[model samples]
Target chain A: MKINTTNYEEYFLLYIDNELSTEQKTAVENFIEANPSYQKEFELLKQTFLTPEHIEFEDKVLLYRLEDMEAKLPSTFKQSLYRNEAKVIEGYFNTTLKRSIASVAAIVILIFGYNLMPTTGKQNIQNQLANNTGLPIIKNESSVSVSANSTQNRIAQNEVPKIAQNNTKPSKTLPSIAAEKADNTPPVVINESIANSAGQHVNNENEMRASPSANNTTVITAVNEKITSNETSIVAEAKEAFENINTDNPDRTIYIANMEIDGDKLRGFTRRIGAFIKRNKTEKEK
Target chain B: MTDKDFNNCVDAYSDGVYRFIVKNLGHEADAQDIVQSAFEKLWVNRAKVETEKAKSYLFTIAYHQMIDHIRKDKRNNTTDNFEEVKSNVNISANGELKQILLKAINELNPTQKSLVLLKDYEGYSYQEIGEIMDLSESQVKVYLHRARLILKEKLVHLEKMRA
Candidate 1:
């Protein structure tokens, strides 16, 4: 039987590999024998399939080198969860866990402190009002006390005697007195005290006492005048106090400096805490 | 694949991978690096690669890495010329045929050299070669046949020279 040479390349490969049956092989052989010019090409095609020489090396050495290469590979991938287990645990404790713990602690302390502290300014004003009404009068320098009612009665009845005792040197003005008071008093007292002292200029002490509203206006005008007159003296006293303050006490200096710095830091810290609380509250509301 | 299976894969496939790369690249150091990198990639993606398919996976990786190395070395002017590589092969006294074949193999392009090595040296089927080479089976067969023809022609020419 005649075989087609046109598509014989595939059959030729199968024939060379001995994949064809005996009859097919015989037919391919008959075809090749008949085609004399195709003989050299067929032999070359067979030679091409001949296994090429491999680089010779000791099998033991190659295997050993391959084992060495295997040893160099990482046991696991870098991004694999198994590989990064320790780091993830460490990072949780170091960053996320610690930060959350600290935040919770700060918020707790802020809320507790806020609940304990007084909320309104009215409490301080009420304390001053109580002192003005009937409390014991504490002398500024000596800390000696007299009843407020008695002090007022004595000032009303024996004003001349008190003036004589001081040899008519006008008493230190209210601004100076107010400046010396360690606990900050309201400015209203400064106006009232200065107006009372100006009673001599009006020559009408009973009239000053008669109408409270008129007395308040007169006190305001008198306080303004006193403030203008005493501005230079107040500045001079301030400069003297600043200059004469003893620098020998290092502990006191450090304490005062620390107090000033701590005051500013405390204010800033409180402001931040307040803002944080406000934000959380707003978020809760939303 | 579990770590143990991956390790088993390394033991099973490392030598074959090394031989394939070394034969293709003609540089033992680069072959070692490519082989290790291939195993490392297998370990990285072991979750995605089935244990049975690890051998193919490794060879595929090593083949691509070898190609990349060739391209990179080409750009860097570090690729060894065919003559330079031919001169470096240590031919035994009676190994003229081996020397001629090595020289002939070196003359083929990098891809053809790789195809011939995978098919003949590693005993991979045309389909396996195609999978590793990212070519169709027919394409692999054609390329392998063309590569073998070149080698045979060179070998015949050498034999004629000797005669």
Candidate 2:
């Protein structure tokens, strides 16, 4: 094949690099056969760029280096183990701290609740006694009895009765049975009527004491059956009057100063107050 | 990639990569270290790197590693007069020609040295060098030509100095 000698200079590097097409390669080969100088230049460039020593060194060193790199790489099982251990330790620390904090908070709450709870056992006992007592008056009686009984138990045998007397006698120090019996010697029916009359008299006295005329007057027959019974009758009459007044004016039972006002009156009063407040606020702004 | 696969890639490419690094760096110890480091990087990216392209990937790592070393050294002191060792150059005549050529390569711009090494010693085509260096093929070729001219000029000067 005839080769283009002039173009060989431009394509010489490509030819040496094995990058030229088959036809171009054949042309370069034929040209090299024709020109010894071109051939010499080719060999010189090749020698300059691609030394045998460097190529051989690269080949041998690369294989050895790669083997070393392979040996340095961690095995799959070791990597997996490392990752798993990390996760497990993280989970353990996170959960342990969380649980510990929760436990500590719960203990603190328990202690706070213990302090907030009622600590007075005596108060609790008194509450129970008051709850069990039929009357409010019996609560004090039970309180005294419990204190006396516990105190008597703590005393020595020789000094027990005297201590019991000192404790119990004070609580039972009201008028003796004989004195009370003597005071209550009146007939049962008379005593009941007296009590009823006394209650009515007390109520009438309280009402009269609050009146303007009471300052100039005196409660001269407070225990007198006639006046007490008379006051009782007056209360019954007043209560009947109030009942009749309430029934007559079912929707407006408020009677102030003989003036019967309904709920509408209060609402009107409130609205007037509110309007006055608004007017005052507007005036202050001005 | 599995450990076995990574090891296999290492076995296939470490020595060549190391020799290439040594040639460029001119230091046997740094070359060996850079080669090991390159393989380690390959091992790290084994999952992303395909076995078929592992050699190119390894060379790419070694190239970057060598550049990093140069940059690091430059930060410490001036590497402006530093020399490169051509992988394919013979060490005859007390390493004078190799030293001169390396000095010439170091004198070339960063892009020129990289382009020439990729093209000549690594045996990468102009297009392949461009892909690795993120430049156009024409740019790589231009830079490579400039580098070769510089080396030739430096060699002539060294020859004159010998005379």
Candidate 3:
């Protein structure tokens, strides 16, 4: 704590290096002045401070990575920098062409999905009757032994009377807490099926059509308004286009871009065009 | 760190590092090599190092490389202490205190020289000098104080002999 003859060097070093606080520095100053003999030693210690030399590193260029940093355009990707009217128009046309092709492909897929998907009401009821194991087989006098393959036909003949008479017992009343669990499964929208069957109602017997192999599920029928106006318009356009292209003879082969050709060869030419467009599209993607 | 950050490091700390090395090693080419090696190491490890710590990081690297260079040179060749320096550089009766101080600093061991350089030249605190030289803070203070005393003794000895 005291700066004296013995411990004074450490205090002097701290003072010269500016490590001492103001109070300690003042104390050190007083101590040095009190003993003039130590003043010369402090002065020599102060002289030990090394003056900085200004030596510039000349080849700092070697340390720089000029090749690593390329002048990059900002992230906004300034589209205006690429201004070209003809290219823009070409891009628009290309996008429209791709959309048209996509629309045609979607229509073809929908047609296939529609054909494979929905069950007619009578057919689904027959399937349900054949599948529901809880319902014992009614081998009445009107029927004999039923094989697995003809189970649907046998169910149709026997179950028709019970179902058509509206004698299907209502679903058993479950606990009040779980009363709605009967419909807990997602609602199965039979809108497209009902739409296609016209007058025959697949919506009515939806609950009764649970095949035995199908999981124990309650079918809820709800009308779906999923088709948008754009989709309807695309379908209509596809229909109009289809009708125009499909004709009985060359005279009736609706205008092929105003070029007349044998109707037979038109199919092959269209196929080739489709193949070429598909090939070019895949190449561009790559 | 990005390339831009690394280049900024080179621009900012290269001169300080080069100056420290050259003054201690007393050879421009070897000091340049040591400084270049430090920068190259910083470049490789830029990602792990923060930009805020770049100056200390550079100094730490250059200090060690300079030490290694000195060690290798000591092994391969003989070295001269302050007496040899005094024998060679005779001023007309101790003319320049600056020359005497410079020669005296060069006479210090590598660690002592680095302690003085980081302390006075770079204005580093005792703690910071310790980090650069891998010494403890207390050790840095003791060693640096010892080095300054040696420099002072040299100056006083030379002046007395000449006087």
Candidate 4:
């Protein structure tokens, strides 16, 4: 800056602040020397700069943290609980893994328990099957052949004689059902419910004779149909139970040594959490 | 910063920071409280703070706290009388120029006063003062220069009246 009457103050301020280089400092000094009146202004400005006061913060000791406070403070609550901190904090990951395994096992138990529960509906089905002479053949073809009042399934290699004895007893309506079968018409659906209301058919044309012997034959036929339908329901329920377990070998529903959790959501959650734990462990090790 | 470095900071900078605060506050207890708080912050952030920057960091925290304290307690302590100060400066011996200068400093507002304090008392550069007070370098220079001119007027007035 050209140091003169109008702008000497700026230069003087910068001069005192030591912002000016040697060349600028020399120029300012020469200008001040040339002008005696501005020298007093410069002197008075210099007096404005404050002097340092010697004062001390006496409580410096209060702010000191030379030692780790955590080391000094005993774990009073942990000690009172009579638990080792190391034992509690460590092995927590292993405990979590064990818990996941245990949970999966618990899930397995819950599934089997629910599937195998002897529900009254299923008990009726089992009782019906047991009454018919326990054989897998009856379960294989769930529907009976209504046209001949004969079961549709092949005769069991062992139980054919028992079924033959039951079939030999002729019913009065058997001839009429056989005549419909010979004509290739659909066999009539029978209803012999204890509810007389339900015994009424929506299609009245195919209604059967209501003689007492005909009624007995109708009741027996309806019972077999029920067992047939119920057995189908049991097959479906068993299939659902097997589907819950991971069966790489479809024959095996569950094997403790080769168990694989099937639910995608549960598997993904466990995998992410396991990966997170493994990452943390690796980072800590590093 | 290490524990040794922090202790070293306390020994070295506590006096300078206390002096800076008490001068601004005009109250010993408040200054003591502010100085302690600044050091406490230094201790808490010792890991982040380095030994080289601890002094400026402490002063920065202390200066801000002082400003807040002063704003909260406006002219509450040591309320100055300009007329009384003028009269006293007029009559006082030339030996007491430092005392007269201090009174002149008290006449300035907080920002201007801090500029003067940081510039003259601690010998901080305009850049360093800007960092402490969160001002631009040019702003510090302009504000400080204006404050210095006011002080100069006061001192010059006294000088002319004395003659």
Candidate 5:
């Protein structure tokens, strides 16, 4: 009753589990049915591993329970489908489109109104019209009103006619007046004085009213002086910060020192390391 | 298909797919999420999935999604407390056997594990496993054989331990 290793090992488990193909199954069945010892071994292996005890769910109750549990299990697909459902836009499409068109129209109107500034300076108006229409100012429509107002104001003054007559009388006194004004104005106010030389002496003072920088000159000068002083102190502070920056031995990655080491000092420290090691050896020998 | 048709398919297959996912994933929340994601994919691609093929398609999605979750989670252990195994003594021997079965299943590589599960749990034939896994029938057989051998080995080990 010697069972060959290959046959016993191959068919023993397969025979137990009833997993052999039909022909092989028949062969194993016939063999086991004849031999009680081999049959016992086959049954032991099968019952031990394949018995319902190992897999408790082979019965109808367990199968029914699985069905019941499956029945109770929620449909995840439906939940996901509900979650990803396309959002419904509830209102009428025509209404939404119409509202959007109206909004665009209002934005266009506001942009046009904002560009039509009555009091914008000539240069500012030129820049705005260039920016708005993305066109170079061939003749900026925004500046025409300001120019007309200036011309009308000039006509009302009767000052230009007088200035023309005075121009005929005043070549000798003109330079003297200009020289006196230039000498009296500070370097800080030189730009304002340059603007004042444009029309009549009276007109010169009137044009001075239009100088953009004139009113802010005092405030700008105080700010400039303060900034200059602060700049010198900042340079000094920066120099101190640069000087105080520590450069450790790159290999060591860190160093603690009370005093700062400059580039030259760092080189010196690196060179000293080898000599220092030698010195330590000599001292240890002593 | 209409939303109603889609809903019907969902009703038919959700629980089965969910049970399969729960068994594979072994966690209630992870299984639920994977099941939900699988359904979302079906809903999004409802036009592509037909009613006849809906159950298999749903399971295909759930299986892939479960694998993806497992890959991301990196939890290698496969022994999940039979959330389905409620009362202990009713199937005492069956519980140990089931654990050994799952342990054998868990020892399989992903493709093998999937093939065996589809065959044993879902009752799919070799051709069906091939269709789901995008393998040839011969390839499925090879992997199934390897998986069965591993299961048999584990079963043998369990028997020896019992002895």
Candidate 6:
């Protein structure tokens, strides 16, 4: 019954909970009454214990529903782990893996397509020459010979004789022709008589005539001097002649004789011609 | 524990976990998700967790998850206006003292609110709460005492206003 002043709170809580004996409760009540200020403190402590507990029935229902859902959830832990692994694989395929595969395919196609392009372009140029000239286009190792038919013979007389022939080796390939075109080199003219003979046999005969052993060596020397001296004028005249060719003239089969240009060089030449035509057309429009 | 034992743990401890989380967060959806995730973590380490200590393991996982969520919520400012929302709820009705007490409980910081819930609603001892919350028993006791005093003061003030 001797409630210590420092331990008053301990007794007060016990008194409110009815844990203290009847005598102890009476003594605690007397202590509070003696100190009137302690009465309000005691009442507040009692009210703290009197606070109501809030039970949310709706929350209980929701928890029960959640429990039901969790109970029905798949219990195969390993399978769930495997499903996550499968998701990783699927994600890789959707992103990085798919992009890598597509990139590889694109690179392969580009390389193969680039390699095949030159041969296809050569065939197209050959076909176009055959169609226009109506001459059987003879493809040699380093020369494309279009035999001057009756109509081309007249055009050949005027163009081929003015420019002198050179006894240069007959090793002119298409790539060399592209190099020449790139350098803007002067065009070389073959003899008009050989051009009129047009074929593999005539090319061989001309090769023999231009050889060092030939009896026409003086004629060949004189022709080479004229070609070297008049190169610039011949190039200009040839370019002008090419520009004046009436492409719309149905009767004219323009035979561009053995200018042994390869597919790539031919394509380059065609591109330059196309650009020239485009520039003229644009200029006229303006 | 086997898969069957883990399932049994889920049935046994899920409701307590949900109640503990929901009371602390006051977000039913987040509480359900946290409870489910805690059980999943237990199931992952079921071979290591003893059947008898499964409840403790589950509660520990949920407590850490709640701490992470609170930290994330703080970063996102999701709970910034919580006090404004609490102030708007009218708690002056004669029979609505329960609501007022809950609102006051919500006003506590996440740590204090969690301690109050584990101790009162889940009936966890200070030592058990310390193990779940990763605090020492003495720290749990001190924090729990402070939380109770705050709740007491709030309840007293509200009661006076009603009178």
lDDT tens digits, residues B60-148, model 3?
98888878877888898855434543453222333388777887888788889888888777888988888888999999999989998
RMSD of each: 16.9, 22.0, 20.3, 12.3, 27.5, 17.7
Error of 6 at A275 (Å): 54
Docking class of 5: incorrect
Per-candidate TM-score against the hidden true structure: 0.44, 0.42, 0.48, 0.50, 0.37, 0.40
Clashing pairs in 4: none
* Native contacts conserved, per model: 0.14, 0.10, 0.71, 0.69, 0.08, 0.04
User: How does model 5 fare in lDDT?
Assistant: 0.50
Better of 5 and 6 by DockQ: 6
DockQ of 2: 0.21
lDDT of 1 by residue, A83-155 (tens): 3335433322455665675585465455445433332222342344344421121222122122222222222
On residues A1-286, what C-alpha lDDT tens digit does candidate 2 reach at each position? 3456665544666665445799988878778887877786565444335332343234433433333444454587677666433443332235567456456445444543443343343335334434433222112434434433332222211222233233223222111111121233333432344344334434444454444443322332332333435344443443333233222222422444686545445544545544554554586588
- Residue A30 of model 5, lDDT score: 73
Candidate 1, position A114, lDDT? 48
Interface RMSD of 6: 6.6
Any residue pairs clashing in model 1, and if so which?
none
Error of 2 at B59 (Å): 1.3
Give the winner by TM-score.
4
Model 3 ranges with Cα > 4 A deviation: A66-286, B78-95
Query: Residue-wise lDDT of candidate 4 within B23-109, one digit each (tens)?
Result: 676777777899889988998898899899999999999999998897777656546344553452222234577767877888789
lDDT values, one for every candidate: 0.56, 0.52, 0.61, 0.61, 0.50, 0.56
* Model 1 CA deviation exceeding 4 Å by range: A1-3, A13-39, A50-286, B2-4, B79-95
TM-score of the first chain alone, every candidate: 0.31, 0.22, 0.23, 0.35, 0.27, 0.26
Model 2 TM-score, all chains together: 0.42
Docking class of 3: acceptable
